[model samples]
Target: DVKVTQSSRYLVKRTGEKVFLECVQDMDHENMFWYRQDPGLGLRLIYFSYDVKMKEKGDIPEGYSVSREKKERFSLILESASTNQTSMYLCASSLYGFNQPQHFGDGTRLSIL
Candidate 1:
């Protein structure tokens, strides 16, 4: 079975602080994604990587960046955290193919004060 693991299920940080979120997949998938979920706004893609050492910016990438130095691990970096960035961050991994289903992590609920 495929599994996606997040480093933390809850996180708290202050404004202007740097934050790092980590995710790992066990299925050796070729695609990984980071998304932020908010009520009403739904899930907004933050970034995605098709292969190791490659990344693409998603819908909301203004204050965020990603690193995929290893195929099993993906990291999300918040350059400068702010109150507006507080939300549920989710990580997903999928096989490289058309219409492939993504396996998601439990998510990290981030709070910025």
Candidate 2:
């Protein structure tokens, strides 16, 4: 089984503060994704990378950035966190191909005050 580990389970920060959440995958997956899940909005992809040093912005990338210096690690950064940005962030990994299921981490619940 593939194991995806998140650096933090929960985070609390004030508005305008810079924040970062990290995720690491045990298996060598070529595709990694960062998504933010909201109550009614559903899961929205924030960023993704298919290889090291390569990244692509997902649906909602404003005020957020990602880095994939290594294949196993992906970091999500909030340039200046806002109360509206507070949400459950999820990380997933999978092989770059069809019919592959992405293994997901527990998720990080962030709160901006």
Candidate 3:
């Protein structure tokens, strides 16, 4: 079965700290995505990579970055995190378009204090 695994289910951090959230897929998918979910705004795409060593910015990529050094793993980095950056981070993997459904990890709830 396909599975997406996240390194942490809960995280707490201080302001100005650097945060790293990791995700891995076991199905050898070609695409990986990072999204932040908030109360009323819904899921907002932060970043996504179509292939290893390649990535593209999504709706809100201003304070976030991503790395896909391996086919099965992806990492989301928050450079100099802040309180307002706290949210539920989700990682997903899927085959390219044609209405492919993405498999998602449980999510990392990061709280920047």
Candidate 4:
């Protein structure tokens, strides 16, 4: 079974602070993704990586960045967090193919004060 774990389930941060959200997958999937969930916007992809050190920008990548130095680990970086950036962030991993089922972490609810 694949297990995706986020570093924190809930986090609090102040505006302008740099934040790092970590995710790890035990299944050794080749593709990992970062997304944010909001009420009206639904789930928007922030970034994705297909291999170590290779990243691609997703739908919403303006204020976010990603790092995947290792196959099993992916990190989401918020350069300068703002109140509008507060949301439920999710981490997911899948096999290297189309239509693959992705395993997702529980999510981290981030609040920016």
Candidate 3: where is the Cα deviation over 4 Å?
Answer: none
In the range 7-57, model 2's lDDT, one tens digit per residue, is 999999999999999999999999999999999999999999999999998
lDDT of each: 0.98, 0.96, 0.96, 0.97
Please write out the lDDT profile of model 3 over residues 1-113, one tens digit for every residue.
79999999999999999899999999999999999999999999999999999999999999888999999999999999999999999999999885899999999999999
Instruction: Please say which candidate is ahead in lDDT: 1 or 4.
Output: 1
Off by over 4 Å in 4: none
TM-scores of all candidate predictions against the true structure = 0.98, 0.97, 0.98, 0.98
Backbone clashes per model, in order? 0, 0, 0, 0
- Kindly report which residue stretches of model 1 are placed more than 4 angstroms away from their true locations once superposed: none
Model 1 lDDT, residue 8, Cα: 99
Lowest summed lDDT across 10 adjacent residues in model 4 is found at: 39-48
Q: Write the per-residue lDDT of candidate 4 for residues 1-113, one digit (tens) a residue.
A: 89999999999999999999999999989999999999998889999999999999999999898999999999999999999999999999999998999899999999999
Task: Give residue 110's lDDT in candidate 4 (0 to 100).
Answer: 100
* Per-residue lDDT of model 1, residues 1-113, tens digit only: 99999999999999999999999999999999999999999999999999999999999999999999999999999999999999999999999986999999999999999
Q: By TM-score, how accurate is candidate 1?
A: 0.98
Give the number of the best model, judged by lDDT.
Answer: 1
